[model samples]
Target: MIDFRYFLVSIAAIFLALAVGVALGAGPLKGELDQQLRGTISAVSKEKDGLRKQIADLQEGDKYRDSFAADIAPDLVKGRLNGQKVVVVALPDADNGVVKGVEQSLTSAGATVTGTVSMTDKWSDPSQRQFLEELATRLVTGDVRMPDNGSAYDRAGVVLARALVTRDAAAAGRKDSATPTIMGAFGEGDLVNSDSDLPQADLAVVVAPPVQAKAKPTPDSDANQAWVSLARSLDSASRGAVVVGDPSAAGDGGVLASLRADKQARGAVSSVDVADLASGQVATVWALAEQATGGVGQYGAVGTTDGALPKRPTAGS
Candidate 1:
């Protein structure tokens, strides 16, 4: 609808404006613009260097703390769990190093670690539900009673707990007569792996897997809930039980996180979310001792309403 001349004039005006802007950038405004750009770059460089130094200092501080905790760990946990028999239960994907560290810590606390029971991936596999339920039903003996109504894992927890742990101090460190048969069934079924000579323990420590950054399972997912059920059942069946994991395991979708979010589970079992560290290892010992004395707490770097560690017991307590 516009005239041809007007269109041409508008185009020419635009080009002229661009030319003027280019001239100013190349000539009159060039020095000021370059100075401002250099100033911005210099400020950014300074900030980056400052941030790097701060991060380095923080890292060094963390290293020092970890070293100190490791050095003092033995004395901190010494005799805390004396005369207690503890079992280490390694969940699927559990870190071997963490499990070993936990066992060593328990030993340092004067507790005898009966053995380690490592759960297979099939322990929580959906397809194994029927097998687990049937096995648990078959394993229920006069000494071990299955819940009237519960998930397959929940019932399996009862059977497993009865085989591995006992609340009676008189029976501690001695295997039940049916332990061999029960554990053999689970082993043959690919539900768990354990030493052949495992004795019944008075307390239990469940080592969970570290958190995954991607594709993390939901807190209420069946697998996680099944694990929670097992842990709670262990606590109910044993003298005491504590679940330990790395700090990342306290994050969303992590087993420790999921357990903490569960009201009933958190109320029954203790947990430590920094089991990968020396401090958390000491905390695990303290938590177990606390459990022996009828106390329950959640400890470590996250959701620790009970504080970083349980109260240290008095000498000879």
Candidate 2:
């Protein structure tokens, strides 16, 4: 309804307002805007530098802690195991350094290191579960009772535990069933090999690494249950069992992570969650010593550990 002239006038007014705003920004606000930008850049730089320094400081502290733990570890673990015999079992992805450290810690504590057992990654694979079940069924003897747990891994674990460990003192004298035939079968399958004389060790230290997170958890995601079953079976079979692991193993998918969480197993075996550290290694030694006396506790930096170490083993225990 308006004339064309009125439309043009409105457009002109809009342009005029824009021009004034530009002029004011360039003429008056330019210095303030530049100063604000400079201040923001400086503040960002300071924050970045502070973060870098903090990271460096944390790294330094870690080095100091490791050194301190190493220095005192030998003294702390000395004579703790006196005359005990121990077998070392390395699970898949286990740290070689931690395994060596565990042996050192145990040896320092006066325990005999019979040898080491290295388990293949395939040992934990769900695909091979049927094979393990078949093997377990074949190996299970008249005296050995298969566990009622539905998991094939659990069934195998119990069968293997019965074959490997001398649970009964009276059975220790037997000639045929006393020796573990499962070791020979394991060697045949190439699932595990050990230097341990098929060792009838009085104590077992099952070493497992941290459980890494790669995908969203599904039913297949939690292989740590296998470890839990094995540790429980091992604990029942041996005089004592101490399942030691890295922090990750105590994390989301961890096996020993639930050692404290599972009320049924908590009182029967010992566990240490920080096996990578000297403090953790020392704790493991004390845990083994503690277990020898029929007492059990969890110790570590992660899930379910009571403290950094278990109560000191009593004299002559």
Candidate 3:
């Protein structure tokens, strides 16, 4: 007789066949799956196209803004700094294009560009701190003293600042003149180079850009602090001083960011953080003019800027 197990096996095989058929129907055999996938892809493509168009519109708007600013810049800066003498100091990482743009604006504003000084990376290198201290003593030949008690970089900054800056050119006289000594010393040591003939200047403007530190540094040990000290000292020594950088300087760990955070330095010197373009460079010159008149302000698109530029002087107000 046929075993009962044979019947059980036959029943199990029938159930398995039915399960497979249902699973296949739910999967690749499903009629609507392909159409659903196509619909999803089409929706995504439409979204991407819309986003592209939006980006293009924004870029075109930016181009128009830049063009408009360039056209109006000259009229805004006419005779702003007439008969003033100015000097440019470019930090190691400062943008050459921006620096040149700034020079052009100063010229357009009727300010004499005395010269430009290009600083080397060694100016702020921690590894050369001791050497900088010795060089600082050698470079500064005048009566100017460092009140910070010789933190190498700080002292060096004070020396350099006093050399490049001065309160009154005529009253102070030759005894106060440190430019020749400083230039000779720096030239001999290769700390700085005059991009052209150096002349006496009544005001100073420093061109710096946002820069990353080489490595992890203690709170006050970073190279950026050197710039802060230099800006402060230069402001004190000169009739006016202003620092010009880009919008990037508003970011974390930027030189302008640090300078703005310092309460003492903030008011001592003026700043314009968007000096990359013609309009911004005009703002930079105007800020310098304001500073020379014993005023301080911040002007930039971002960071600690007080406004786009100082308010236009009213009719003899």
Candidate 4:
């Protein structure tokens, strides 16, 4: 009769506390408790890492913050469009930055420039490959003239392409036999399109490799069929020149030799290896299908070098 209800309540609370204590200490809940602790530790570790990064960033200074447009504006005013346009196209990422750099530099140099800012990533598109291929093809062919672009960068490409074409053309003309026809594969799978605005020349300058072996390999049967088809089509059109750019993967092995042999009766085959090489002799072996007609061209050695192209300056320039 000494307040039984109060004593009962005290007992229930004590039992609940004991149950919790057992769960935490060598009980079923021990694993769950450890997992919670580990999670907390991991969260703290990540926070520490984030803080370290912030400190590093502060130490590095704010060099990434700079104007791109201010740099080109001055050149634009001085009629130095070539260098400016080249710079702009190469650093298309810095569209606004370039515009800003140009504006500032031009204004300081007593010139006014105006243009809409376009900051888009154009290279991400796959069509760029085709565009570049087409441009390269045109450059290799002396017959086609590059269109004149008002922009400086476009003009640069045209100039460079024309120069290469002249050099390559002279080389092709001097070694005159019947002009060899070249067929290249630009598409994927079996649906390769042999018919395009490809050049028809005696020397098919395949722009697939940067540096190839002096000894050209033979083409396969399937490749041979495609080459035959291309040759016949060219023959019917009365085109004297046959040139190939960016050869298909199948244009290897005996197939090339067969093409050469077939042409030997009428003319000679002149091939250029476009495979990029690193640290090896650029060797190309030419083999004729019937008569082991073969020749080789060795190129200088190359290496795995980075920074093949120029880079944009940071905030400090």
For residues 211-258, what per-residue lDDT tens digits would candidate 4 score against the true structure? 134554444333333333333222222212121112222144422233
Higher-lDDT candidate of 1 and 3: 1
Candidate 2, residues 1-317, lDDT tens digits: the string is: 99999999999999999999898779898889889999999999999999999999999999999999999988888888887777788888788999999999898888877668887766678889889888778877777777775578778777766655655533432334434477777667776776323556667899987676884233225366677777888788778889998887777667676556667777787889899999999999988888777878888887445898988775335
Task: Give Cα-based local distance difference scores for all models.
Answer: 0.89, 0.77, 0.76, 0.30
Candidate 3, number of clashes: 0
Q: What is the C-alpha RMSD of each candidate to the true structure, in Å?
A: 2.2, 4.3, 6.4, 19.6
How well is each residue in 1-317 modelled by candidate 3, as lDDT tens digits? 88899999999999999999888779977767768888999999999999999999999998998899889887777778776777789988788988998888888887778778888878788787788889887665547777756477778877876656567755322333466777767666777887322555668899986555564233244567888888887777777888988877655666777778778888788888888877788788788878877889888888546898887742111
Kindly list the per-residue Cα lDDT of model 1 for residues 1-317, writing each as its tens digit: 99999999999999999999999999999999999999999999999999999999999999999999999999998888888999999999999999999999999989999999999889899888999999888988897767878889899989988888888977999877878988999999989998655899989999999977878888777778778888998899888999999987788888898899999899989999999999999999999988888899999978656899989875323
How many clashing pairs per prediction, in order?
0, 1, 0, 51
> Model 4 misses residue 232 by how many Å?
36
Candidate 4 residue-wise lDDT at 18: 92
In model 1, which range of ten residues has the least summed lDDT?
Answer: 308-317
Best candidate, TM-score: 1
lDDT of predicted model 3? 0.76
Show model 4 residue runs off by greater than 4 Å: 1-60, 63-94, 109-317
Look at candidate 3 and give me any clashing residue pairs.
Answer: none
The list of candidate 3 runs beyond 4 A from truth reads 1-30, 148-150, 169-177, 195-197, 212-221, 314-317
RMSD of 3: 6.4
| TM-score per model over all chains | 0.93, 0.83, 0.83, 0.22
